[model samples]
Target: MDPIAPESADEVFLTAEEYEAVHAAVRTVAGSRGAGQPQTLNSLFEQWDELVHEVEEGYGWSAPELSNDLGCRTALAHVWRLLPPRVRAIRQPELDEIDRRFHATTVGWPGRDDQEGQWWLRRVPRHLEAETSQRSTHGWPMGWDVMAFPKPEAVEIAD
Candidate 1:
């Protein structure tokens, strides 16, 4: 890999369609997951490297290859930045409900109150027993908590 050449005023770049094909190829390889082969974001970049080589060999005359590894990495980083949220939209109300439920049994009073303290302690055993019994029968995810939820991208507001 060579250092990135500084863009000259007269240099022409490849068409958008050519680069987009490379990006699409990366997505195609990433999505074709196989048994015992869990893919991560790094795997996408690795696939992109291979695609870049193929593209360079196949279409070098018309579509100039990206300069180097840095170019390939930067191109994919740009693609990722432009991507919309990949996770499902999480509602504000649902997040609020999770927050409420998480804190519901806590004794907020500054001073110790026997009844306030005891109420939560009493609920713990019942909640645990129910969670244990329901887990296997209903296939409820064990230790399902707000922290376990995948964070979704926030809506971008235009000023």
Candidate 2:
């Protein structure tokens, strides 16, 4: 499906409530392991997976289930793009760390032969790029505007 962009530069894709929910979720996961210990790749992947599930449940956008890791990863990529810049700015460091670690450790994209790395680390960026291109060419995801900011009820006009 084609991606949808906001109608104008000033337009908002997600409401403040939605942004807060996602930001809170990121904070909870980022802090789940405590301060001193470094996060393992598995833990990072699991945390991101949980975020993806939360987004799917919260927004009622069914991309795929947890059983399909690749699908969930792809959905997360789209969700990542949907987040407001501020939220992404806060999390970019951690995300970059994940990418760096994954690159240092893994040979290539996770597959039947190389399943050691987090699929998201390698695949998500590609998805993000594709989403951006689609958004530029097409627009934001279908129904996102309505979902994010629903129109108010119409009143009857008197003659």
Candidate 3:
């Protein structure tokens, strides 16, 4: 596919050199300070301000365009978003159901096999924590992986 002419209308129209130049420049100047995080143009730092100008003139693109679109600007903007006052939330309503089933079954079999013997087949709800830590890496936003378990007793018996 020719970068000078996008393969499809949905793609951004630019020359190959233009695309590579902008992306390369973004990577080059986005994190020059060695601060462990990408430097964002939104910051009021004098050096970053100067760097912004250099990027615009260097890439023939404006600062706002840099922020509004993908490329290194979008990545840096993502970093900025993640570096704010945001609390990560975890959904754990299933924990309550797990407790209920565990208690109900164990208590019902109190004298049978028995709760006193510490031996009872338990078939209750279990779920994994689905929480995402509010931290960005490589200018990417934070994310999470979820794992859910079905209630054992609720399993359908095969006919």
Q: Count backbone clashes in candidate 1.
A: 0
Ten residues in sequence with the least summed lDDT for candidate 2: 150-159
Q: What is the lDDT of residue 50 in candidate 3?
A: 41
Give TM per candidate: 0.20, 0.31, 0.17
In angstroms, how far off is 69's CA in candidate 3? 15
**What is the lDDT, from 0 to 100, of the residue 93 in candidate 2?**
64
List clashing residue pairs in candidate 2: 3-139, 3-140, 4-139, 4-140, 4-141, 5-139, 5-140
lDDT of each: 0.31, 0.38, 0.30
lDDT of 3 by residue, 36-107 (tens): 644433231234334333433332222233233223323443333333121101112222333344344322
Best by lDDT: 2
lDDT digits (tens) for residues 121-146 of candidate 2: 33211111112222211232322222
Steric overlap count per candidate: 0, 7, 0
